[model samples]
Structures are given as C-alpha cells and as structure tokens.
Target: MSQVVLITGASSGIGKSIAEFLVTKGFTVYGTSRNPKQQEVNGVHFLALDVTKPETIATAMEQVLEKEARVDVLINNAGKGITGPLEEIPEEELRSIFETNYFGPLRVIKAVLPTMRKQGSGLIINVTSIAGYMGLPYRSAYSATKGALGLTTEALRMELKEFNIKLTNVAPGDFATNIAAGRYHAPLKQDSPYAANYGKSLALMDEHVDHGEDPQKMGEAVFAIINEKEPAVHYKVGAYMQKISVFLKGVLPSKVYERLLLNHYKL
Candidate 1:
C-alpha cells in the first residue's frame, strides 16, 4: 500500500516541493495551504489549512482521514519569519511569530497524534532553521521561534519514542523561499525608536535570503530522511552556513560565537 503523507504549508517553498516529490514516489500526499485554490501538482491533493487555527487543522485532518484511513507521515512545515532587532520588535509581533512558528506546529501535532498512535507507526518532520542553533543579528524574533522549535523537537523525539512515532527536526540553512519576501508587521508600541537601524537590518536580511540555498534541495533532503530506516533526530540541510553554524556552536565560546555572527551579518 502507498504510504499516506500530510504536509503543512504546502502552497509553496520546501513544503510544496516535498509534497511534489512524495507524490512522484507513489505516496498519497495531502498538502495543506491557507488558500483554497487547487494546485495542479501531479499525484498530490491540496487541502485548505491555517496552522494557527485549530478548526482548520481539525477539518483538514478529517478530510485526509476520510480519504486515507492512515497517515504515515506528518510534515510540520508551516512557519513564518519575523525579522528585526529584538529591542525594536513589539511584544505583540513577537507573540504572533511564536504563535505561528512555534505553537502552530504544536497544534498540528496534537491534532495528528491520535491517528498516528492508533496506527502504531508514524513520522513527524519539523522544518526548522540553522538560526535555531545560533542567534543572528536583525533576526532575533525569528531565531527565538526556531530555537523553541529545535528544543521542542528534541523533547518530542524522546517523549514519543515509546509510542513508535518518530520525530525529526530538520534545520536548513538560508533557503530560497517566499518566507523572506513575506511581509512582516512591526511590533506596535507607544513610542517609536530604532526605526532607522531596523530598516537597515531588514535590507541586510533581504540580501542574505536572495542568495540562500534552493528550497527544492532542502525538500530532497527531507525526502531522503523520511525514507531512512533509522532516521536521525536532527537533520541539517545546507552547504556553507548550516555546517559552519553547527561547528561554531560546538567548539566556540558563547561570546566568540556571538562575535562571529555579528561580523557575518556586518552588524
């Protein structure tokens, strides 16, 4: 029987690519997006989903379960990026980022766990970022969210092992995704300050994302992991920065690592 895989944030980027690849591999894929427009991708089904909304998740899962009795894989790929200096970011904006990037996956996982546990075998893939390991200048809010995800993935892996459910956290370096191009709302505050520096930081972030790795490549990496017999708890996918970030986190002192990131970002 073809395995059933459900991927969130499937309208574009890594999620879309993963869904496409899985379909080609003969898996029955249900891709989720906030937009209801039917995508004409071969061998995949698109379902309207908003990860931040529990009703959307419950409804989408019901649709998938109605079609396919079992869900073999759940890819928690729905996330957003909030780029700006930590001090400049408003509390509300920061909370929104956490709501989507962190809690969003949590919601989906809760919704899918019953089916997965009942089936006795399943894989949960969380698409995190290298920023999760180390903080970057001008991306404090984004980094915080991913960092929380990284830790959450680790804990989930340990907690879910006895249930025969696998949790894999994928930390990809900068990828060519619409996430960077997506609009970010600034944190609202009573007094406005650090506006000029925030603008400069956003410009720098844009330049970095424009030259990042391809999302399709990241998708390929994800496919490989899902097919493995003994999948790792964490998978780092990227060329330069992904490897370097892990190395620095392992060997360098905290202050030195911070300096290196500051210099790399030219902040």
Candidate 2:
C-alpha cells in the first residue's frame, strides 16, 4: 500500500517541496496551510490548518482520518521566524513563536497519536534548525522554540519506541525560504535597550538567508528520511550546516561558539 503522509506549512518553502517530492515518490500526500487557497500545488490535497488553533487541528485530523484511515508520516513543519535580540523581544511575541513552533507540533502529535498507536507504526519528523543545537545572536526566541522541539522529539522517541513510532528531527541550517522573506518580524516593543543590535542582527540574517541552501534539498532529505526503514534521531541538512555541526562537535567550546556567533553577526 502507498504510505500516507501529512505535511504542515505546505504553502511554500521546504514543506511545499517535501509534499511535491513525496507525491512523486508514489505516496499519498496531504499538504496543509492556514488557507487552502494559498496552496498552488496540484498533485497533493491541501487541507486548511492553523497550527495555533486546537479546533482547526482536530478538524483537519478528522478529515484526514475519514479519507485515508491512516497516516504513515506526520511532518511538523509549520513555523515562523522571529529575529531580534532576546531582551528586545516582547513576552507576547515569544509566547506566539512558541505557540506556532512548539505547541503547534504538540497539538498535531496528540491528535495523530491515537491513530498511529492503533496502526502500530508511524513516523514523526520535526523540521527544526541548526539553531536548535547551537545559539546564535538575535535568534534567541526562535532558537529556544526549536530547542524545545528538539527535546520534545527526544522524549517522544523514547516513549513511543515500544509502539513502533519513529521520531526524527531535521535540523537544516539556513535555507532560501519565504520564512526569511515573507513572515519574519521583530517584536513590537520599540523601547527595548537592544533595539540597535536587533536591527543589525536582522540585516545580517537577511544577507545570510539570501545565499542559503535550496529548499528543494531540504525536501529531498526529508523524503529520504520518511522512506527509510530505520530513521535517525537527528539529521543536519545543508552543506554549511553539516560542516558547522562537525566544528561544534570537534573543536568549539560553548563559550567559543558563542563568541564565534556574536562576531559573525556583529552582535
């Protein structure tokens, strides 16, 4: 039987590409976004889902179950980027980021667990970032959310092992995605002490993202993971990211890593 995969944030970028790739590989692909009209892809079914909304998640899952009766893979890829100094970020904005990045996946996992448990096999892939493993200037809020996701994936992997559910976390470095161009925003409060530094950080981030890896590569990596009989717990995509991971593991100390990041971003 063709495996069924549901991917969130499929309107664009990595998620959209992943959906397209899966369909090409003979899998039943269901792509989700906040607005179904926003999805222009033809082969996959686009479902309306707002990860931050509980009712929306529940309803989408019900509809998927009704049609397919089983979901073999769940890709938690719906997320936004928040760039700015940690202190300059408002509490509300931080909460909002976590809502979409962290709790959003949790909600979807909860909704899908029952079905996966009943089936005795499933794979959950969380699209995190290299930022989740190491901190970078001006991305504390964003990185923290991914950090939470990393930990969540670890715990879920252990707890769900007996049930034959595989959990994998994909940590892509910078990717050329609409995330950098379309939805990124600094926190609303204008009076923070780190405002100047925040501005500088955003400028640097913009420059880096412009030259980042292709989103399609990320999609290919995700497809490979989903098709694997034994998936790894963590994967680092992107050329620069793989090198950085090696450096972090072999040479850089925590303090040295912090200094390197700060100097790179001029923070």
Candidate 3:
C-alpha cells in the first residue's frame, strides 16, 4: 500500500498544496479542514479537524487510524496568524494564536506518537514560518508562536530518534495564499503612538503575502523532505533574502541586525 499521509488544515493554502501534490505522487493522502465541503478533492480524502479543539483532533486521528491501520506521515500544518504592535495586541488574542499554532501541533503529535512508535518508522513535519527565525515589527505574536514551535520540533526530534520516528520543521517564507484574510490584525488606531509605523508595517506585510512565491514551490519542498533518508531537523523554503536573513542574524552584531530590520520595514 502507498504511504498513508495525514495533513491538518488542508482545505486551503500551503497545506492543500502539499496534500494534492502527495496524492499525485501516489501517497494515500487524507487532508483535513474544520468543515470540509466535500468528501474528497483531487484524490485527497477530506476529514474534519480543527487543531485548536482536542476532541476534533482525536476524532480525526481515530478515523484515519481505523481505515489506514498505520500512518506513515503526519503533517502538522494547521496554524493561525496574528499581527499588531506587541503592546496593542490583546492578551487573549495572543493566547488564541498560540492555541492554534503551537499547542495545537503539540496535541496532534501526542495523538499520533503511540501509533508511530508501534510502527517503528514514521515522519512528522511541522509547518512553521520563516518569521520564526526573527521577530518582525508588528508581527511579534506570530513570530513568537512559530519560533516556539520550531524550538519544540528540535527537541522532539532527538527525543524520538531511538523510536525510529523522525521529526522536522519546514519553515516557509511568504507564500501566495488566503492567509492574510484570515489573520487577526489589531485595529489600526489613528491616535495610537504606533499608528504610523504600525500602519506602514501592516500594509507591507499584506503586500508581501499578495506577491509571495507560488504555493506549489512549498509543496515540492515538503515532498523532497519526505523522501530524504535522514532529514535535517529544520528546512527553510522561500526567497533567497528571506532565508539569508536567518543567517545574517546569526553572524551580524545584534544592533546591526536590528537596524537592518528597522530599515526593511522603514520603521
């Protein structure tokens, strides 16, 4: 039988692209959404899964396990986006994003571990973001969530190595998708101290998403990582500069790197 692959948040965007691509490659793909409009699409089976809800996560996994008997790969692609000045961002919203972006992935991983350990061979890929490498202005919440997930992936990789279960994080830069529409943006207050800089930064961020690289490129990247004999703990996919920014932060003086970010956002 083909490798059984389960992907969360597969109704659209990067998750959907990966799901469709894997189906074409002959993997038995089960793509999930909080509310799937159909039973299947492009040869990928649709399941109802909302990462933020533990009950839904459990139900989805149970359904997949019942049918497949073994899951070869688990893709934690479900996440939410939030942007605003750190001070202006509501505490509840900050926690909400973490629920979907960080804790949700952890829950899914826990749900699948037993089966993966039993099989003695499995791969778990967490879809993170390039922003996770550095905190972007007005996007601190999003960056923090992704950054936390990335770090968690690194730790989990080593802990699960002896079980023959491989784990890795794939951090993608901006990709053309509907993410901007779904992201939570703190209302731009005209009288707020951060009004000018925050407004400009928010516009720039949306424009970047509007013109981001094709989502299919991300699909291809994930496919390549899945085929690897021994994949690295982290993989980045995006524009050259976006990937290079991560490296620059490592080598440049802290103040110098901070200046570069300020200039980039024109803050």
The most accurate candidate by lDDT is 3
Comparing 2 and 3 on lDDT, the stronger one: 3
lDDT, candidates in the order shown: 0.83, 0.85, 0.94
Per-model TM-score versus the true fold: 0.93, 0.93, 0.99
Error of 2 at 91 (Å): 1.3
Candidate 3, lDDT over the whole model:
0.94
**Segments of candidate 2 deviating more than 4 angstroms:** 38-40, 187-196, 241-251
Better of 1 and 3 by TM-score: 3
Task: After superposing candidate 1 on the true structure, give the runs of residues whose Cα lies further than 4 Å from its correct spot.
Answer: 185-197
lDDT of 1 at 30: 93
lDDT for 254 (candidate 3)? 95
lDDT of 1 by residue, 1-267 (tens): 999999998888778888888887788899999985875467678898898899999999998999888899999988888866577677888888899999999999999999999999999999998888877766778888888998999998899899999998998887777777674746433355756656666677777678878778876887899889878988888877567788878898988887886676556
Question: How far does residue 233 in candidate 3 sit from its true spot (Å)?
Answer: 1.0
Q: Across residues 72-176, which tens digit of lDDT does each residue of candidate 3 receive? A: 999999988899989999999999999999999999999999999999999999999999999999999999999999999999999999999999999999999
Q: Per-residue lDDT tens digits of candidate 2, residues 1-267?
A: 999999999988889888888888898989999988844466888899999999999999998999899999999999998876666567888899999999999999999999999999999999998888766677888889998999889998999999999999998887777788665576645687877777787777787688878888887898889878999888989877545764674576877776767777787
- How many pairs in model 3 have backbone atoms within 3 A of each other, for residues 3 or more apart or on separate chains, i.e. clashes? 0
RMSD of each: 2.3, 2.1, 0.6
Clashing pairs in 2: none
**Candidate 2 positional error at 252, Å:** 2.4
